[model samples]
Target: MRKSVMTGVGVITAVVFTGGGFAAYNLWNGVTGGTRAAAAQPSTVATPAAKASAIKAPSAEAAAAGAKAFLAAWAKGDFEEAGRLTDRPEAAVAALTAFRTALTPTALTLTPTAERPQAGAPMTFRAEVGLPGAVRVWRYESAVAMVKTGDGGVVVHWDPTVVHPRLGAGKALAIRPVSSSVPSQVVDRKGRPVGAFPSIAAVLDQIEFADDGAQPAGDGTGVVVVGSAGGSGGSEPLFTISASKGAKRQLTLDADLQRVAEAVVKEQSGPASVVAVEPSTGHVLAFANNPAVGQNRAFGGATAPGSTMKVVTAAALLETGLTPDSPVPCPKNTNAGGRLVPNDFTDARLGYTFKDDFAQSCNTAFIEAAQLRLKAGSLPAVAKDVFGLGLVWKTGLSAFDTDIPVETNPEQIALAYVGQGRIRTNALAMASVSATVQSGTFRQPVLVPGKAQPMAARTLSATVLNQLRSMMQRTAQSGTAAKALGSISGAAAKTGTAEVGGQNPNSWITAYRGDLAVAVEVQAGGHGADAAAPAAAKLLQLGNSH
Candidate 1:
């Protein structure tokens, strides 16, 4: 008898005797080549049809179960066990080991397709592979080819395609640093470069990936998977990866307004900041800081607001039955909790109205009004209840909201009334202050579109709203703000020069025109009319175009 070798896993070799053209059947293990069974009579040779019946094929269910077991083992990092479930154990082990070492995957999930496998067919599955700090999970579909074994069991048919559908023969998977050809970037609402406004660097740093799945720009040091494609033996990128640094994130800031604000603040020799907002929606148009690299004082610093605090003080007085025409005394110096408070200019007039006090920023008038008419907690109550100040403001980023603590000390209350002693605010807060007056309601400021915060429950009465607008208009028309904003029709503003224990005081101005509101602060930049008002005017001047 002569025997031919059938060299394969679980393959059997058949023995043929050349007598009478008949073949004797013998079952021998392909690996061991040991005889298993001899034909009983060694009769005629078996036909091709009969020989095919001798080998039993696995059922479709058996193939699916075997594929599932192999995937489970791979997902669990059990390369050895996974290899044992495959037809070629050594090759499977080597390839799987290489995949793990090269990819360093943090997570892996394999989901079988809804359709079950047919006999001797590939079992399709969805693969979601994850890497550490990757911008997103890499998703693809692959299949598990199954084969029947000699032991009446099914095993995975090993092929490079099982790991990745694109991984052909002689190809290996590897992760390399992402090429700088595609780096993450951000843009303003008008598609301008976000980095152009150096003052908003802090705001940009707080944002991450964009929701839209657009491709990233420029190259980066991020992670990526590179490999050979279609058995070409040439290196090519299979996947680009990165941390959640978005390719392109869009901000709510208007690029035109940002340019104007940056240019305005740049005119200051000392530290300066400005914030602009849309009164109708409370959307932040622009926020800029001079020198561009220091702390985000435009949105976070809580310095005293000087006479700008009178806006809230006036609201408190209006809430307590005082009208804009109500008589108020603005003496050269008045007693406030035994401390002498003086106005910017001595008022010798006998009967000045509440409108005069606000327009002229009379420190004595507001101090005496709060001391005589308002209760101990009235100022903070009004700030929180009506103006939305002193409340948690979710502006989609880090910001210091207004802080007006309830004061029982009459001395502190007197100072706080004129925006001095414990009244702390920033340009963002004061800009919203003007926005509330213009909108007749408190709309929380938002820098990101679709991130608007809940509005305050209380709204300003129409009477109080009209009075505040009229008083601010008068100030812009003839008072401290006239030189900077009076020429612009319908413009309204309030100017302040806050005492910060220095020869040069902090300049502050809050203004609104049409649907826009803005505030400016210049540290040690002299009076508000000279320093902050011009910056605020420029911000409003550009709003007409937007």
Candidate 2:
């Protein structure tokens, strides 16, 4: 036996009893209808069975009403009420939640194309979406299916396609960064094309493609609407909305110096980078990388600075009443923080002056001094308070600021004093370090003119600056950097060789002449003087000529 139930009030056509079962027919002429069961006389037992059926289906007007309520609730952001109007409440709720969360639309509007009843199960509407960095609204046609329920009412059929026609099951909407159209060209300080210099092309690409809108004529970055099953990366872009602000953008780079830097790094045997800064104004004169295709290592590299960190260490000691000529001990190797530390130089002197240790790049002398006289917070404090090492930089480009975390371990602190453990910097930041020592002030470096710069907390004291300059000058004149610096007059420098376990050490050199300060690095280069110093000297020479 089969039984059927009909909803709403309706006209009853007939009722009959057969084979110990009953059948009823519901007939309607467009009004509401319901089914009723009544006992009937057994007159047709063992005869053909009759089936119950409804004569009328829901009208198009009714489906439109149901869709109106659901869409109204959704437009008001009342997702729960909207879900209740759908056939699958749970699925509808989840999809709606995901739609709002993923797109992050600043404004959303859904308007039905026609208010009049439509002769279709799926109702169509215009979906307009707005985003934060987008220049225009994204508009498209979307639809939902209206279905009749067992309760004799209509409901919206829940499906991912209801949210977006192209949206598939288990997929989501997302916004991603696209290259902008405005500021179409990047130029140097003198308005020459920056793309010509392959050495700094990666950096120029980042700035040109950055998603910023601060400049009135710079439209920053473009945005795209994508339907993705995974993260933003590898997503399929469905629509692109481009923005426009300016025609061209200029940087603070000097063309001649940039060419010199590019040429110098090209001659290195391994990966190398050079960054030059103007000491007085904190302008980045030039920055270059040997293989300029991948990462912009000149500004974003995070590696141990080796003995170049002695500049900060020496400053911290100078704050403690130690002068340049103060007598200090330089041992071949000494136990520091439970580890035997040694200097690059083999000769051990009992009364080497502080100047001698700095000029000779003595690791043991610095380790011993820090172990006895300094605390864990001493170096970080001096780095932040004086030279602006760990501050947020707004250089109008992608850059990795120097990171020197405060350490409590004696071993780590000892290593940090000589710039080995837990200390990381880039060529750009090291150049800024030398610039600060040259000018006695920490002027934040800038690539794009008029970008806001972070204020340096304090300037190096006159006494400390003078002594550091004297020691660095001695380094260039008669110490490790002597041959590399050659005849560069009025120059100061410090050389570094950072060990990386099984790999050859990274060679480093930071130096300044007149108003120009430069830093050079050669990855897997054996010694600072042999590799990095020559490049630094060449860049400093070209930079000073400007």
Most TM-score-accurate candidate: 2
Each candidate structure's TM-score, on Cα atoms with residue i matched to residue i, is: 0.62, 0.63
Q: lDDT values of the candidates?
A: 0.73, 0.72
Count of clashes in candidate 2 = 8
Error of 1 at 59 (Å): 86
Estimate candidate 1's RMSD in Å: 22.2
**What lDDT does model 2 reach?**
0.72
Per-residue C-alpha lDDT of model 2 across residues 1-546, encoded as one tens digit per residue:
111111000111122223322232222221112211111111111211111221233578777677767776666555556667776665665555555444445666666665634665567766666655654455677787777666576777777777767666545555554444335556677877765678654444356333444443333333333434244334444544443534566788888898889998899887888899998889888899878756788988899989999999999998888888888889899886798888877889878889999888999988888877888899999988888899988887778989998998888899999999889998999999999999999989998887776768887778778989999999999888888885889889999988766699999999999999999999998778989998888876665654
Task: Give the 10-residue window scoring lowest on summed lDDT in candidate 1.
Answer: 2-11
Residue 477 displacement (Å), model 1: 0.6
Residue ranges of candidate 2 with Cα displaced over 4 Å: 1-182, 208-246
